[model samples]
Target: MADTTTGSTEQSTVPRWRIVGPGLVVAATGVGAADLVATLIAGQKFGYTLLWCVVVGCVMKIVLVEGAGRYSLATGRTIFEGWRSLGAWTTWYFGPYIVIWGFVYGAAAMAGTGLALAGLLGGLSVTWWGILSGLLGLVLVWSGRYGVFEKVLAAFVGIMFVTMVGAALLTLPNLGELLTGLAPRIPDGGLVNTLALAGGVGGTITLAAYGYWLREKGWDTPSYMRVMRIDNSVAYVVTGLFVLATLVVGAELLYSTSVAIESGDQGLVDLGVVLQDRYGEWAGKLFLLGFWAAAMSSLVGVWNGVSLMFADFMTNLRGGTSEDPDARAGGKWYKAYILWLTFPPMVMLFLGKPVWLILAYGVLGAFFMPFLAITLLWLLNTDRVPREWRNKLHSNVLMVLCALAFLALCVNEVRKAVVGA
Candidate 1:
């Protein structure tokens, strides 16, 4: 099959601990500084009252990612290929989406990395740091292969795991409260935070890119199904814990004082200052480093992963035959999109984001998660995939829940963008 990996079926028997492939890539890519701020703001606002949403969000991503991986393995096709099979309308939606989302997200991701660096080293302006970060991401992914990219991303995840969780521990969470947080509850006026926690934070276009990463990792066939499940489950569980740790910091450190942070990415920078004031300088410096790692990882991951998706999209749009993502990993289209992600968006850094562009980015960005959930429901439940590999009842239920949740989030995102709220 065009999509089959070169690896043998026996490879799946390797121990679960050794199975940390595309799952980690997807997870790290999904959790950027914006996600941290979202969770941090949630913690600031509602304390642990919305903690259950973290677990729910993790499971939601797991199901969506697993369904995406399963479709690829079972059908020996890419997710883009699966989407194409649905109809030309899928192409219409995806074309505009990938273009606009890439343009806006490139600038946002670059600026995020720059913000962390500016916090870490007070010498350079954020605009220069942001431009450098984009250039750095381009340099990192422009040449390296998948294995090298994965290893770099793993290092970033290590920094993310230690620093965020360390901050949580520093706050000395209330054990009783931590336990109580596991119960589902929503505070007053927390409806948006509740939905954002469940659907938005630590997830986005990267979840669907799981399949592309799988192909790159040589887990491209159904024989690796068990391993894929293990990878997906373990990665998101870690992400959930990381988020829980962020909430702990919010609830234990900031919530009690009723401190307010500047909205958006500046909120995380505000956190570094608090850490410095309360725990001394090392804690603050470490958190800043971790923040840089998180932002840079997302930047690099998108530089690689989304470019792969765009490559596949372009190839399919040209009526090209099915091709393995790894086969075209750094091909012309991949390189072109990488350049697009790196350079053109830099203008936004200096001139500031245009209101219309921001609106398009928000509305389109909000629509994507629900789009993936609904389409996966369509693709996996039908004869499009083999009956044995089709979504089981539990899978169907989780995906339905994901669709509904994200749809609510979609409405909220659009409303907020439209009104500048």
Candidate 2:
């Protein structure tokens, strides 16, 4: 499968610990503040009963991401390239999906970052803050240097881990109950919540960007498979820990109390205020900072990673391969998407998201996970990837389960969007 389209062949001599770039970027990017809020809500509603779901979510992500990385390394191809090999239909599905997904997601991510900054600094409109956040992300990713982008994402992940996990520890949750949460007993009336927490933790379209990051990190050959697997596992384990800690905070801090918070990003602000009143101002501010880190990390992650994917997609759209200059980092298509993610979305900040746009975004977004799962299953099982890297029976089982799980979630989301519309 090695071909001229595959780029440089530099083998990684760095130890596994030092080879943690793309995995961390993908993992951090996947766990935005919204994910934290979902985990918090899970804890609030069901206490430790659904902690097992968080673990399940993390495992599922690891499986899917690892499959993506494995395919890229084994075949020396981008995920986009693999999808194209599937058929022209994949291109048709992805083309409009990415455009719509980006416009909606850009606004959502910027707003999320703005909400965090507004909560932390105060005295500023969230819309303006969101605009500023989008601009900052633009500048950061516009450089097109993967090394710098990875480091920035790493710093943000550090802040998020410290603040969130620290807050959870401060709550001093019961170890016994936390352990029992691993037993997988769903509480009464907790089906949807259980599915969401199990299937939704740290999940996003960015998971598909793992292979791009792996290529950027120079892990583009089959020899790097073990390292890729290790990197993916470690990264999601950290992701799971961060998410679990947030659950602890919700269970100990909110579940036991009578305090009620609103839904969405604003709910996080409400929780921060509760922390201030109950645990003192410092605790609240720390959580707010963590929230900002989560949001900003996601912004940076998507800005860099998705732009790379878009570049690859554009290259393939024009009959060029992943090795085309336009598909690489700092290429024209890469910068173009950076601008798209930054500027156009700012309009939503001022005009507010249109009802139709929201409906379209929701409908398109609902299909991405299952789309990714089904594609991965197909690409991996076929001759597109080397036989050595083909999905094992266990892997195939997990992929099938992942597909079914995301399909169910997709149906649920579509139902909500249609009903809400």
Candidate 3:
């Protein structure tokens, strides 16, 4: 409830719209290739029936991300510092999770970016493209200024939204069926798939990265809370629309055709081929390009945003603060974590991820959202934040619901990974 935009000569001097900052970056970072593929698969199999899930996904993200930004502005503490205040249990879980998650995620994100590029430029190998994508992200982030990085990310997001959303418009699906998708109903064999699609859509560990980006944007106090909320709401509305477009395309074109999409990014490639063969090569090419933009933007977003999270993790774990020289963005610990996220993971690209490493990644990845929700539940309720800035009854209830929903999905994720179910 505090106004971070207060006590500012710049607020009166500068243009009001210029305040759009890290909220956009964080939202863009949250939607990657996997998310797009999930939407595409939902569209392909269920038509617009799963469109409601996209809406729910966007709402869930808004709650979690807004919570992140709120905590930072309210407490003037980094999420790392906030988590540590709760108890050692947070730091203990986060320490291993950050390291292991980074190692596995780097390779996966690079490959997704690479896949999109390879599809764009015909006959190129995915591995080389992946490396190129990774390098490009590294260079942009390494530049060390938040404004420059945010603008670059914003440009990529523009390309992705325009192209993908345009494709959906071209499909021209029936408005009646589209409206029906807004209803929350599940069909046969859809319980698990519905949950997965609902949970997976627009959800990622990157949700927690919002606060760090806010700090980088200098929206560090309660005055910017309203601005942050508006920014977050607008960004996710765009995201929800983009995902809805994918669902529309899937429902209109593939539902009755007996054309099944493969799981993961492969399904998107399948979509490209079908689009090209059926609608013309240009359609295929445009979708693939948009896909690349989505994938690469996410890669850069994660590489940049999550690196901030990991950096803060190390800094806070060692009891550092926002002012501690070693804890700052360009400081030793920050750069060190960035390196850990980038280089070591390249080994897995060649040698294949070890079974144990993959297991650890899956188990930890499964619980990350719930971990965030539960921690936010505790953090927001605690005396650390000013009483007025604390969560209202509605916010707490939504978070608790978000926590339970994600926890149930986490159990399912563990079961799937462990039992190969």
**Clashes in model 3: which pairs?**
2-222, 2-223, 3-222, 3-223, 4-222, 4-223, 4-224, 5-223, 47-251
Instruction: Please count the clashing residue pairs in each candidate, in the order shown.
Output: 0, 0, 9
Cα error, candidate 2, residue 233 (Å): 0.4
Q: Poorest 10 consecutive residues of model 1 by lDDT?
A: 1-10
Tens-digit lDDT string for candidate 2 (370-415): 9999999999898887776788888988889989999998898899
Model 1: residue 169 alpha-carbon error in angstroms: 0.7
Q: Spell out the clash pairs found in candidate 1.
A: none
lDDT of 1 by residue, 154-258 (tens): 999999999999999888899898889889988899999999988754669998888988888887878888778878888898889888998999898889889
Give the root-mean-square deviation of each candidate in angstroms.
3.0, 3.3, 2.2
Candidate 1: where are CA atoms >4 Å away? 1-9, 12-17, 324-327
lDDT of 3 at 188: 79
Cα error of candidate 2 at position 118, Å: 1.0
Candidates in order have lDDT scores of 0.88, 0.87, 0.79
CA RMSD (A), model 3: 2.2
